[model samples]
Target: MATFNVRPDIDAAAEKLGSTMGAKREIKRLPEVLWEGETVEMLATGSYGGGTGLVAMTSMRLVFLKHGVMSQTVEDFPYPKISSVQWQGGMLMGTLTVYTSGNRADIKNMPKDQGAALSDKLRALIAQGGQPAAAPAAAPAQDVGSRLATLDQLRATGAVSDAEYQERRARILDSL
Candidate 1:
């Protein structure tokens, strides 16, 4: 098992869901598939492609996990790769559809409220250019001369168009 940070609200929600035997089992298996710095934003249980699994929305991606007696399956959708999400609610449950470039996944039988909330959050994430709001780490400063030389080389090789070169050159100069 692995350990990663989870949002406070998601943790509380997970605890409530963990009271069920199946949910507890799935929750315990969550850490195994998570990335080192990934944070779980939301979680729900649903059926996809006829397999029942846990659907988790994390800081960087969406994941579906199913553990059988001797086998386990994991499917992940990175934020940038997702095109859109759709939610349809019924009396007691809802369906979530996630679309990517060449594929789509339908997760059904999710709790109505959870499905709706997840859809809204996913939409917000997509609207924000699929990036979570996190402070960027400070990058090591490079010498202005070397930066300009690199930019010039790129322009010479036609890697960057003239307009782009001009814009970048101006930006580099403005930093001085």
Candidate 2:
């Protein structure tokens, strides 16, 4: 699946929601619109901490309707369909919206299946969105002098066995 960094504000909100619901939930990196409104936007939901377990989103319209809180369809929110999703830093992120509807849409009383489907859809979409960015290269090798110094400190602190020190010293010397 696609990975994403959870925004602090959104993370906190999801955490709070999880606490209130008393379920095993956590903020995910993926995002989705699933609907279309006047403005267009994506929606994301995960197990916060309370009762909101692994819920998914695929269609904002379906999401709202499932929640029993709907006034229009996907063409009501801001964005329409799956626009984009990718990894930023260490998190998956995406954009979504409703089209042709009003200015805003919401979900409060949707069915569990639909709510969950929406979440699953978002996750799946993220996986299909694109390949994630690569991580930075590893740190360069440290100089032998520094490694010896560290080994000395470790020995003084009784942090290494005599055998360990010898083995490490040999390795350090080989690197020189």
Candidate 3:
């Protein structure tokens, strides 16, 4: 079975996965893998909207993994979901404001050293505006019609193989 949440941030001596996550996960560590295709570009640890955790930038999405006392909250916001991204920070700390299609969130109290750079990177990403196709597995579930169209586009563009497309199509249909 595939392991979940085995990020590089966790100590090697400890388990790579966390109990707060999936059933087959290796516990006692922060998750390393956010998604199958997610390639982490930059990561910064700090307070995200009053919660303590890490913010990771990837080639495909902007991911926020927050750790609570007993569980964790993970948010992977693709560029398509974001309408605007603003970085407000000082030499010590700052906030990242994001406006999505239906929601707006403020990821605040990020360290200046890492936050500023991450904010800049996020700005650049948001400016790029949307990936070519549908959302990843880690992304929040989108509407069925759009999702299907996205899957088709992915297959046509050679981004996903026929088998993968079939699997995803089955999953989408099953969800309905």
Candidate 4:
């Protein structure tokens, strides 16, 4: 459960989220992504009125959850995965933008004091170094024939969309 510093204004919520967006959703169990020793630090709710959600942080990971009247979206990023965090606005309300190597999330409508505190925590953790991600295993180099066969199978099995299938097939042919 989160204790909000500012009482949220329901009528100010965005059309997509509805006026009652921030109403609590089930969070009785810890998310599976939490590591054994992780501890929750900051917990906040409501953003510059764009929607209602929770931004929870641990020593190693940042978790975001948007709860809507009918839908909920959740995202998690380890400190090592976050390339940067941006703070916008001041004291009363603002936004925090977090960037990863390949993705970005703009967490807005936060109070200035909380935002600054969260930013400091994020920076400190990042500076100290974060949990290292396991490197992906490299795929063995395959012959052109085998690569083409794999692409064909992917297309047939609907694992690859049509455009991707065509592009891959063309690339494989060009390689040969």
Best by lDDT: 1
Candidate 4: worst-modelled 10 consecutive residues by lDDT: 7-16
Q: Each candidate: what lDDT?
A: 0.73, 0.34, 0.58, 0.56
Number of backbone collisions per candidate: 0, 56, 8, 2
What is candidate 3's local distance difference test score?
Answer: 0.58
lDDT of 1 by residue, 1-176 (tens): 22212334345558545223345445555654665356677888888876788888888899988877667789999999999999999999899999999798999988888789889989999999999878233232434554566567656755457998898779767866
Tens digit per residue, CA lDDT, model 3, 1-176 = 23322333222212321222222222222233244344456655555555666666666777777655566677778777878777788877788877888788777766666667777777766666666334336443444654566567657756557998898889878876
Better candidate by lDDT, 3 or 4: 3
State which candidate, 1 or 3, has the greater TM-score.
1
TM-scores for all candidates? 0.68, 0.22, 0.55, 0.53
Instruction: Say which candidate scores most in TM-score.
Output: 1
The deviation in Å at residue 68 for candidate 4 is: 3.4
Q: lDDT tens string, model 2, 1-176?
A: 22222432333434433232312212221122121111112233322222222233222322321121222122222114434322212123221222233332233332343344444544454455422123233233533554566567556655556887898789767754
- Global CA lDDT computed for model 2: 0.34
**TM-score computed on alpha carbons, candidate 1:** 0.68
* Candidate 3 C-alpha error for residue 125, in Å: 1.9
In the range 1-176, model 4's lDDT, one tens digit per residue, is 24321212211221113122253441211222233344455655545235557666665688776656565566778888888888787668788888898787878877666677787778777676765233233233434544555456556755457998788678656754
Candidate 2 segments whose C-alpha is farther than 4 A from its true place: 1-142
Model 3, position 159: C-alpha lDDT score: 50
Give candidate 4's error at residue 137 in angstroms: 27
Summing lDDT over every window of 10 consecutive residues in candidate 3, give the lowest-scoring window. Answer: 16-25
The runs of at least 3 residues in candidate 3 whose Cα sits more than 4 Å from the true structure, single-residue gaps closed, are 1-33, 132-176
